[model samples]
Target: MKEIAIAGAGPMGLLLAIRLKQLGYENITLVDARAGTYTRPGILNASIFEELTQLIGLPVDFSDSYHLKDVERSLYKIAESLNIKIMKANFTGFEGKALRVEDEHHDIHILPCDLAIDATGSRRALVNEINRLFPDAFSVQPIADPSHKKHLMAYVKVEEKTDSDPPSTPAPYGFDFMVQKLEELRAMGWKGFVEPGFYALPLAKNKTCFYVEIPENLDASQHEKWLKTVVAFHTGKDNFDYTLLPASRKYGSKPRFLTFIVDPHQVNEAFFQHAQFPCVIPVGDAQIEPDYRIGIGIKSGAYRIKCLLDAMVLEKDQEFHIDFEKYQKELAAAMQMHAAALSKFYQEKQRSYEHYANLLSIYETVIASASMSKQKELQPSFAELIQAYAQSLYDAGNNALESILTSSGDIPLDKHGLIADEKKLEDAIARLIDAYKYAQGDLYTMASLKLNEIAHLYEKLADVFIQRGAYGSSLKCYEKANMIIEKILKDRAESVLIKYKHTQTLHKASRYEDMYDMACQTLSEIKNIGMDPEEKKKFTYKLELNKALALLHILHIRKDLEERDYYEDECNKAIKHVKSSPYLKDKHLLQLTKLLGEIPIESMCNILKDGDKSDLAADKSKRR
Candidate 1:
């Protein structure tokens, strides 16, 4: 009998041992440093379960998912039943045709084996030793994007409740409607996005897991702090459970950190042949780290083991030799395909975000217009659109929470559970456009009130996107907000709030010229419009402050003495206006004056001397 030693008793290692034993390998030893520890859940597909059942000649209890601990325990039990020796030891290194392992008692022994498999997953114990011994035989390359390498995860258990009736009526317009829908999801323990990199998955009726993708440049120690920051930003009284419990002590799920294998190590035939070691092969994450988001690596590992077992079949009259070449070719092919799929998956994610942003803009515009127009005809269709979008989010989020896919599969990249019917959004936008086109004089202004509301809502959504780290999506939202404001302004609509928002968006977009123009126009309009004494004082102070800030930003891009004097004068007037207002408290006036005074003249002049368009963008980005 040929002796086989498998290092690392993770799901991949244990599964490999169990399969080898079934293939009539009598002497198999499994070595692991962490033999009895389980930190997260294991993902399994129904197809994998089918294959496992056939291999073991026993029914694999099929389930939607299992904890990583359970998967390890089950496989360990099967290994024990098969009388395969398992050592609670660390695989130290290889010593000339044998594996060197340190036992639990710290005694070193050279394990003699005809075949050795490195199933050590990301640790890559045996694989790394081989690379060190024969550096030229393997090529280790880091993935193009390291964004998927680090992850943070935690679990929470919510009490199961009896079925309750959902809301019968649709929610009101603007932010309140979104708040209500989110609250409904929270009550049912539905999983959804908290931030761009942060999301939740429901494990069972009472259990859920929250995951956060760690940023590449962030230090490992600051992971907890970053998670807390994201939670605090998104959490409020109504959606507290959705955001707070994952990182909070009340649920008792302190976040755990996991590192994925970012660098894929490819082994050439020389490593196996030229190393002069007998049949030392790398498998599972030791060979390749499949994308962790889908947990496809485990499935891939299982499939490869089955192929390896088949390749191990001995012919009656032939010398026994493992087909290392075939295995390497298959491994390379699989990794190539996996890499392509992973790239496509991320591209799909970006597209999904864009689709969601588009749908959200259209829905917000339609609903806000319906409110402004007070046309009973628009109300029913607007309500249906709201219901469809909310229901889609609920369904898609729950589906994602329930199962971890083993493949990229058919992820709804274009739709992404934001809206069910593209036609609905298109129809609604068309209707709103028609309403605006048909309105006359005062009615035109009334119809265009939706523009102001939509612009304000888009600005708020953009802020949310910024908090979520979706910088591109946020920029798009800001652009949309500015576009709406432009539409309102073009119609000569009367909304001081929209004009103020226009100036802010232009500043954010780094369009300093447009901002200055809008600010100047708004300041002129404020003079003509009558307002209450306190209200007018507030608008005048804010508008003048924004105007001066815009001019200062413009001066950063170019040296203009006229513009510099104009900004200084504008700042003084704003400071003076804020100070004279009876509505302003002493502290408020002091803070306002300090805000204007703190713009460093020398620094602004230095920037003006050496600034370009890139400098202006950089300055704006820093401010944001």
Candidate 2:
């Protein structure tokens, strides 16, 4: 039998002791400052947790906030029945083959033990020691991200009038119940938790537990006020509208608050082993804190305990600590993967919130307008419809962005990760185009919403192709993107200026030649488009200057005289327009002309590829 001392008799610590006994370790001891096994207030999914508790021959009803005191009480009885030792003591540290322990009687003693495991929650002493003595083993923030300050959560009991329908696994991926709940809240004028942060469980016949995720930036004092507002609006406290089935917390009791981290996984540091002969380690949250939104903290922690014990059993019943290094490495890798997935999940929630809230607001406005009318329900305003359409377009664009990771196994470390997934990006562009087509036909898209969205989508798609070595496809994508922009901008002169904004975005992504052609075509089109003379001149000068700079860049790439002369021609055009037009005179254009004059272009074109030729002679021959 291996002698092991497990600290902090929380669920993980207690369960670990039980697991060791099953693995044939007889001299196992459980210790905590408080005299009990513990569980915090949380709604466990109960699938795996019950199995862990069952290992100790203890049973949980799985329908209530598990009380640590009661759990510890039960653990003590079980220990008594099995002849396993339970100690009420504060652990100081390890002193070789014994534990430096301070008992409840205020007496300090070094108790003989081979291994000391820390299962103390967030504020565990081992974490403090590691931070104080060996700083590199942990991050600046002990258990969670240093950036995430403790935030408040309120658990005001909503009075159970209709009664909850017993505890059961919620609908699998059951967003409908959540959607219905959100609709009810929206109708009742109470909205906080929804698609992203909202969660509820049918606990018993009396009350349903609701969680409100407050961001870390909020203040503590606002907890009561925020909860009160939820209660007041949910219950219709002012109007007594029982028909609304208004939700309210139990009357007379104030909504209380407790502090917890919103995103715990942001703390990346996993563990450090201080000794070798007799090993000690921190388990569960003391190692990796999970995002509470996933509801897997307890379950994940218990799983770790099982892994630790399993590793020990495989080591031929040697002290469990011997195999923990493997556990730590595996734990770190799993934590990393989980953190990435959680971040994606959180970001999706945030995006959905933004998109849905805008649409919800518009729907509410249309409803309000209808109610105030002396006639039938009014139609949504054109502005509201257009705004909703814009939001939809925005969502479609974001979906494309996400596919860069999802559809393709593209992650940051992979050479073909992020936006470099060409095939996936092409598929995303197709989806966006389909969405645009439907929106155009469905909502009578009267403006440039579909056009601009499709254009930008193709721009991104082009960049992806470039990364995948499909330069021809990239150029085609850019051409389509640029054509749509020009087609949309043709009706208004100011819109031409808007089209120029995309050039830099294209250039920023290394699409210089594409950007150059876009600028040149827009400038030429601006001349034919009906614009105020002064406005046309100003845009013309800007476009001409950009075209000259682009050709100069092209010459650098080709080292060909044809490209250099093209650069000079663009500069001369700007100069001629500045001198001839009465309304146009730009100092920048004259300066550019002077610079162009200084550049000595050789008399003949050389190194210009036959297929790359784009000149007035070629155009006039085609016209003839």
Assess candidate 1 and give its lDDT. 0.57
Per-residue error (Å), model 1, residue 418: 40
lDDT of 2: 0.53
Model 2 reaches what TM-score against the true structure?
0.56
Model 1 C-alpha lDDT per residue in residues 467-527, reported as the tens digit of each score? 6655555556656666655555443434576567656666666777777787788778777
Which has the greatest lDDT? 1
Could you give candidate 2's per-residue lDDT for residues 369-420 as a string of tens digits? 4445511322323333444544454456546646554344332124543335
Model 2 collision count: 2
Clashing residue pairs for model 1: 42-68
Model 2 residue pairs with clashes: 37-72, 158-249
Q: Provide the overall lDDT of each model, using Cα atoms, as 2-decimal numbers.
A: 0.57, 0.53
RMSD of 1: 21.3
